[model samples]
Target: MVAQLRIYTINRGMMASWLQLFYEHIRPLHERLGMPVQNAWVNAERTEFIWVRSFNDREEIEAKEAAYFASPERTALGDQPTRHIAKIEVRVMEEVPATAGVS
Candidate 1:
C-alpha cells in the first residue's frame, strides 16, 4: 500500500470554513472511497490541516483521488478560502525495526 500526506494551508481567516469542508466532504468521501485514513490533524498554529490516507497501489490511488477531487462537489468546496494548500506530499515510509527483542 502507498500512503499520502495532504497538507492544507488555510487563508488568513478561513479555518472554520475549511473544517466544515473536512467534515462535510473530505471525511465522508474517504469513507465512501473505502480508503483507510490513518490520521487527521489540525495544526496548533491553526493554519493547516494534515491527513494521512493509504491506498493499495499508486495507480488506483491517483485515479480515485483525481476523480474524487474533480467532482463538482469538491470543486465548490475548493473555491473556499485557503492559502492554496501548502502542498500535497506523498511518500513511501518504512518503519524502523525495534532493537529490544527478548524480555
Candidate 2:
C-alpha cells in the first residue's frame, strides 16, 4: 500500500471555488478510479489545499491517473480549475510499520 500527499496552491481569492470543484467533482472521480481519499486539510493561510489518498501499487496509480486525465468528464471539468490553481505538488509515501501505531 502507498499514500500520495497532494498539495494544491490556489490562485489569490480562488480557494473557495477551487475547494468546491475538488470536493464536488475531483474527489468523486478519484474514488471511481479506485484511489480513496484518506484525509484532507486546508492550511492556516487557506490558499493551500492538502489531501492524502491511498493506492494499492505504483501501476494502479499510473493507470488510474491516466484514465482520469483522459476521461471526457475530466477533460471538460479540468480546465475549470486553471484559473484557480497556481501550483500542485504530489509526493508518494510509504508508511513505516514500526511507527504505525504512533500518533
Candidate 3:
C-alpha cells in the first residue's frame, strides 16, 4: 500500500475555520471518492494540520487525487478552505515491514 502524508500550514487564527471545512466538507468528498483519510492531527500551536491517506497503488493515488480536484463538489467549495492555508507539504510514504524479534 502507498501512503500519502499532507502537512498544511494554516494561516494565523484560521485553524478553526479550516478544520470545520475539512471535517465537514473536504473529508466527506475524499471518503466518497474512495480516498478516506486515515488519520489527522494538529500541532500544539495550531499552526499546522497533518493528515494521512492510503491507496492501493501509485496510479490510484494519482487518479483519485486528480478526480478529487476536478470534482464538481470540490469546485463548488472553491477557495473557502484553501485560502486559510499558508503552506503545504506533501509526502508519499511506504511502511517498512517489521523484522522478527526486532522490537
Question: In angstroms, how far off is 33's CA in candidate 3?
Answer: 0.3
Candidate 2 is scored at a TM of: 0.87
TM-score of each: 0.68, 0.87, 0.90
lDDT computed for candidate 1: 0.69
Tens digit of per-residue lDDT, candidate 1, span 26-73: 777777776767888888496777888877776777788787777776
Candidate 3 TM-score, C-alpha based: 0.90
User: Scored by CA lDDT, what does every candidate get?
Assistant: 0.69, 0.86, 0.91
**Most lDDT-accurate candidate:** 3
- Order of models, best TM-score first: 3, 2, 1
Off by over 4 Å in 3: 99-103
- Candidate 3 residue lDDT tens string, 1-103: 7899999999999898989999999999999999979999999485999999888877799899899999999999988877999999999997766784687
Residue 55 of model 3, lDDT score = 89
Query: What lDDT, from 0 to 1, does candidate 2 have?
Result: 0.86
**Span of 10 residues, lowest total lDDT, candidate 3:** 94-103
Summarize candidate 2's per-residue lDDT along 12-96 as a digit string, tens digits. 8888887889899989988988889999998848589899999987778888889989878789895796777789999999766
